[model samples]
Target: MEENGLLNDWTNEHPLFDNGQGDKLSRKSIAAIVKKYAVKARCVNPAIIPEGISPHSMRHSKAMMLQDTGINLVYIRDFLGHSSVTTTEIYARIGTRQKLEAIEKTALSPEPGSLPIWQRNRGLLEMLENPRDVVFNYYL
Candidate 1:
């Protein structure tokens, strides 16, 4: 398609891929193309393409790939034209090993001799001990 100049003239007025008549390809046309290629790929390797693969599945796979490459969810949301980053978070799902690795990577290690702030503050400790007796001011 690139060799045929279909990919060269992309603009706001022109779509990336189009039908022969200079119009955008319909959803059915795009699905048919994907299915055709998937069938051909399956002939070469039956395990490569799964059954019931659709354009939406391809889109999800691309989103997951982008997420796996460390791309931000906000960026992925914009790339996928999603209205909300929360919607894009579906692709941010990680496996158990990935979750553990991420947690370990970000795990906090306190300084050797530094005490926690609550332990160091006598007034805060008193406040914790007797909440009603202590008058907490917003400025403090």
Candidate 2:
């Protein structure tokens, strides 16, 4: 191999991820490579590669990882070759864990004394305790 025009001892004719002809691997070739590695990985641990894992799933995983890292959705859209940001917005939907994390991060802790007197009123507590006793006057 050559590094900055300086010859090195590394002597592989093809790149580690290239096709045998020193060209970029085709989509099918890439899928085949992923499948081969997945099979090998399954031998080590079946949970590593679940059934029906495909190249598309890897792409989706990468998109999710990018979203989790706070990368802009527009950038992720471009990276994933989406026609519009709307298409990329699917990945922006927060999971349950992310929703909880966001809530925890922004949760407010107010002093008990800061609440209005109405909030602590016994009438309000009684109303909550006996919802069936309350009558609705929607016309009013």
Clashing pairs in 2: none
C-alpha lDDT score of every prediction, in listed order: 0.74, 0.68
Model 2 TM-score, all chains together: 0.56
Looking at candidate 1, what is the lDDT of residue 93?
A: 61
lDDT of 2 by residue, 25-120 (tens): 888988888899999999999998977778988888788788877789999999999999999988565543454455446546547767444335
lDDT string, candidate 1, 1-140, tens digits: 65766556455568767898879999999999999999999999999999989999889878877887778889999999999999988866653345445544654544789754444667755655555589884211
Given candidate 2, what's the lDDT at residue 130? 50
Superposed Cα deviation of residue 104, candidate 2 (Å)? 5.6
Worst 10 residues of 1 by lDDT: 95-104
